[model samples]
Structure formats: structure tokens, C-alpha cells
Target chain A: MLSIVAALCGLMLVATKAFTAEQIASNHHSYALKTIEHLLQQEVPATFSLTDLPYGECDNYIVNQISAAGYVGEIQYLTVWRAQQDTLSMRVVRHSETPGIGDFIDHQRSPWITQFDFESAQAFTTLDGVSGATVTSNSVRRAAIGALKTKDIYCG
Target chain B: MGEPKTKQTRTFSDGVLKRNPAWIQLLGLCPLLAVSTTVVNALGLALASTFVVVGSNVCISLLRKFILQNARLAVFVLVIASFTTIATLLLEAYAFALYMKIALFVQIIVTNCMILGRAESFASRQSVGKTFLDALGTAVGFSIALIGLGGIREILSQGTLLAGAELLFGSAAKGWTITLTDGGLWPLAGFAPGAFIVAGLLFALVKSLGRASTEQPPMQLKGES
Candidate 1:
């Protein structure tokens, strides 16, 4: 009797898990997209794509073309905002970091992120440091500089 | 032999105080250590564990007689795994955001020693009523320990109680987040070391209290010569 009851309950639970798998995947995808959109406001073209390039090889034309320099590091750069476009907005999306402390750079509380708003691509190398989150801050700066350099290459 | 009512009461009390799965027995340390990072996380884990424990106890007790003696362990695992899967699904459907945050830990509950421990030690041999009471007592004790650990971590680390209140208590409690830290200080409570230290302190405190209660001499019965 007990085995029968247990089996029945077990079957019910499995059925529920099967039913919700799709919903979980959908929610995960939507959440990821929203996070990306929030960080890189719509001023840049919405048709942008993400590509993984080697640390030293990322083509940051904005920094290289405008300032004659590039960054060194394995980074992801958001190539948005053509030079012809009056308004330019771009950013590096994510990085590996310890939670809570280093992760603050990803959130709005960190001044480091907003510094990218109006600064020239050359300013990426000289942005003020985020006191405790220096490593994460540097990573973001490198990625941003590389991205801007890449943008200048393709769009300039 | 049928156990006396007083013996059953004693067993139930033991589940709550003397042999609590979290504080005293020290079972299910995985979820206890992982999810206790925040009050809401701990609360959600506690509720889910309680449901599985109690539900399994009841179901197992009902099936005790007919279960093959050799296959009882297999039976228990299946029953527990089933409940855990159901819990994961329910969280996904309704509490989608929280479900994502606690995804890995929820599945890990399948291996929590406390649930399997109860099945082998108590549920397989006890009456349904006694098993129910025992499971309830054990679950409540575990919940208390989890919430206590979670509350301490949440307050000290984030400098607030219920920093993300809406996740557990709904939007009405959205503005209830208290700022304990001005984003200053290395937030120790949010990390793994913080969890180990807090759990260690709580364990020591409970152990000392248990010693004190046991040291007290029993009162002499009025009719005893």
C-alpha cells in the first residue's frame, strides 16, 4: 500500500517537472535579454551581435583609430553606434567576478559604468578607479576600450 | 509491542530539541549551508524541506507493511526524489525568479541526509500519527535553525533584513528593505565563510543548552517510596 502511494506521488511530481521545463527556459532567455538591453541603452543599433575574440586581438578601432592604442585581455566588446550616427552608446556586458562585492560593478551603484556615457574611446584607458572593485573595473574598462576600437574599425 | 503514549511524546520532543536535524543531528548540511545566505532563501528551502519530509513520512508510514524489506531503501529514494521534482516544478511555474536563483540548491535537497535518515530510522517502524508528529517536530526544528542562520547573514551582510522582501513576501513588502550597510565594509555575511562561522556558533549554543537541561536532576515522584 505504501509503495503504491509513493509511486503515485512520484509520478505526479515527474509530470509537473515535465510540464514546466519549457517555461523555465523561456524565462531564462527573456531575463538575459532584458539585462543586456538595460545596460546598453538603445542609442546603439539594436542589430548588434556578440562575438568572442582573443584577449589581445579584439579590434577596438575607436581607441586605436582615434587615439592610436588598443587593449590587451580576453574580452567581449559590444560593437554598436556607427560613427555617422549622431548619438553613440556602447558598453561591455559581463565579466567573471565574485558575487556581492565585485558584482557591484554590474549594477547601477558603481560609478564606473556610467563613466562610459560621453567619454571618448581614449578615456577608457584613464577612467578613475572603483576603490574596492579595481579588478572588475579594469576588466570592464579594457572590454569597453577594445569594443570602441572595434567600432571605429568597422564604422569609421 | 505497542509503545506507550508517554514514550511517543518523549520521541516527538527528542525530534524537536535533543536531536534536531539541523542544530543537533547535523543532517542536511548542504542546503543548510548554501541557502541560509538570506532569510528568504532559507525560508524557501525550509518550507520545501518540511513539505518533503512530512509528506514522505506520511506516505512511507502508510506503505510500511507491504514494502519489501529488501527494497525499502529504494522505495524511500524514489518517494523523496518524486517530491523534490514536484517542488522544483512548482517553483518554476509560480516563483519563476526565485526558482532561477535557487535552482541548483533545490535539486540538491534530494541528497539531504535528514529526509533519508527519518525514513530509515523512524517512519518505517512507527504508526502514522506518531510518524506525522515526529516529522512535524523535526521539520520545525530544522526550519528554526535555517531561518536563524539566514536572518543573521542577511542582516549583517546586506545591512538590512529582507533586502529583497518582494521575492518572498510579495510587492506589498517591496519598500521593507532596511539599509544596514552603506555599501561599506567587506560584506562577510554574504560569503561561504560567514555561513560556516554562524552555523558553528549556533551549534555550540544549542549543544550547551542541551547539556544544561540534561544535568538537571529529575524530581522525585510523590507516590514513590
Candidate 2:
């Protein structure tokens, strides 16, 4: 009986996934585009026109999605690396941090997220984190550092 | 408990009014307080939770006979968890923006004592038909509590109704926000403590109403029997 119930559940889950996968993907794509548009401060073209920079090649600007462990769950973000200046900027793409407090990482809520704008990744160690959201701040910092390290390893 | 011989008749009001899980029993306060900051968020969670509770109830009722008594709790939880996952996927697909706002609450519905409590106390013993009605009534009760708290919080915090209605209702709801005040009357209302204050007042109101209804007028000033 347990096996039967489990099997039924599995079947239902598979069916629901199959039905919603396309719409979910489309929604994610639109959301990503909107985020990129806001972060880049420009209208994205019909297709994503930003050149995808291959790793190991230092370029003026490059974008990479990185994930790091946050206070509540994984924090995924898009980081822009400007290797020539050793500066990085990031925007959170997805996270499960507590609302109101940790959510200050959002640029709309507070200017704290702008602290990452065009700053050396090492600056995170000296910067005072958001008063009540240290873990969330650290998560974004970790993601930024990871993105920088990736550039360092491949570009050099 | 022994299996009952017949299905028991119950009324919707019994769940919504007389024994509201949120107002009276206080079954699921975690998500209740966490996600009641806005009407859209509250309603989104309510919709997802309703689906989960109703689906789990129906499944559990159908499987009650086959479920071993010793393993029934595990089985019930498995069913509830499955429904929650499906609800999460559906929300991500249909209401992506709203889903992101209340994703944590929606994902944690599997642990909501309200859903699990109903399964253990009611669905495990009732027929599928009866269980469905019970689930609906409970869901309605929960929805009322959530939306009421959400409305009050949104009014106090944002000074608007349906401030982000578009997230749930699409572009048509873009203009649905009805500004109630020039600015927030109480910005704290947008936070967790605000949820507690409003919920406390709601609990007090319900208690007072229940007390007033149950209180009997003093017997005519007659000698004590």
C-alpha cells in the first residue's frame, strides 16, 4: 500500500513537471532578462546581445552567474567582472534570506547592494555588513569573491 | 480509534467560524505571521496551501483503509509533502513573481500543523467526500484569517490595498492598488512584529466575540437555587 501511494505520487509529480516545465523556463528567462536590463542600465535586445566571454580570456567586462551559501539557503547572483580595473558588481538573482532584514540586499530596498558596485572583492573583508543582515551580506560577498577567483584562475 | 460506521455530517461554518484553525485553534502561526505582510502574498500562500490541504486530505482519505496504523503518520506526511511540491511547481509556473515573494512560506507548507493536524484528526478517519468538505471549510477559514491580517498590514504599512496586485493578477491588476493614505501610517506593519500586533488584535476580537456569544444574561434576580 505504501508503495502504491508512492508510485501514484511519483506519477503525479512527473506529470505536473512535464506540464509546467516550459512555462517555468520562459518565466525564468523573462525574469533574468529583466534583471540584466536593470543591472546593466540598458535595454536588452531581442536576443541577449552581450558577448559571452570565454573563461581564461581577460576582457573589459564579463558576466557570470554564481551561487553561494546564504543564511537560509543558496543565493544565486549575476556578477559582472571588470578585470582591467579589478572591480566587481553583483545583483542577486534568487535567494531565500529572511524578508525585510536580509532582503536589504535588494537594490530597491536599500543602497547596501550598491556597496559592491565597482569595488575590489577584497573590500568585502573591511566593509561593515548590513547592520542586521551580516550573513546575507557575506553570502553576496562570497559569490563576488568566487567570481573574481574564477577570473583570476582562467584569465591568468 | 475504530473506524466509524457512517460518515458524519459537518457544516462549513464549523470550520470557518466555530473552530477556526488560525483564530481559535492557532494551528499554523509560522506561515501565518511570516507571509501576511501583503494581501497578494497572503492570498498567494492561501491558494497554495488550500491546494495542498485539499489534495492531501483527498489522497489520505482514499488511502486510509490501506495504510497500516503504525505507518499512517508517515504516509500522511508523504502525501502532504508531495502536494506541497506540486503546489510549488505550479506557483513557479503560473505566478512566478508572487511565488518568489512567498516562496519560503509556500515551500514550508508541508510542515504546517494545520494541514498535518487535519490529516491526523479528520482525514484519517473520514470518507473522501466528507474529508473534501472539511478541507474546503478549513481552507476557507485559513484564507479569511490570512487575507484579513494581510489587508490590515498592507494598509498600515504601505497605505494601499493590493499594492502589488499585478504580481498575482497580471497586467490588468496594475492599477488595482488603491492608495489609502499619503504614506504608510505605520511602516513597522511591513515587518514581522507588525504581523504579531495585528494577529494579536484579531485573536482578541475573536475571543471577545466568542465570549459575548457564549455568555448568558444574569438570571432574573431570583434567589439562588
> Which candidate should be chosen as best, given TM-score against the real structure?
2
The C-alpha stretches of model 1 lying farther than 4 A from their native spots are: A1-10, A18-26, A42-156, B1-11, B179-186, B216-225
* Docking quality (DockQ) for each candidate: 0.26, 0.58
Task: Report the number of the highest-lDDT candidate.
Answer: 2
lDDT of 2 at B63: 86
Tens-digit lDDT track for model 1 on B1-225?
Answer: 287888888777777877788877778887888888788888888888888899888888988987888888888888888877778777766676666556557776788888888888899998898899899888888898999999888877876677776776678878987777776244787788988887898888877777787985432222111
Fnat scores for every prediction:
0.54, 0.61
Interface RMSD of 2: 1.8
Q: Where does candidate 2 chain B have its weakest 10-residue lDDT segment?
A: B216-225
Best by DockQ: 2
Query: How accurate locally is residue B68 in candidate 1, as Cα lDDT from 0 to 100?
Result: 88
Candidate 1 chain A weakest ten by summed lDDT: A61-70
Model 2, range A34-71, lDDT digits (tens) per residue? 77767657675685632343222366666677789988
lDDT of 2 by residue, B66-157 (tens): 99998888899889989999999999999998877788789899989888888988899988878887898899999999999999999999
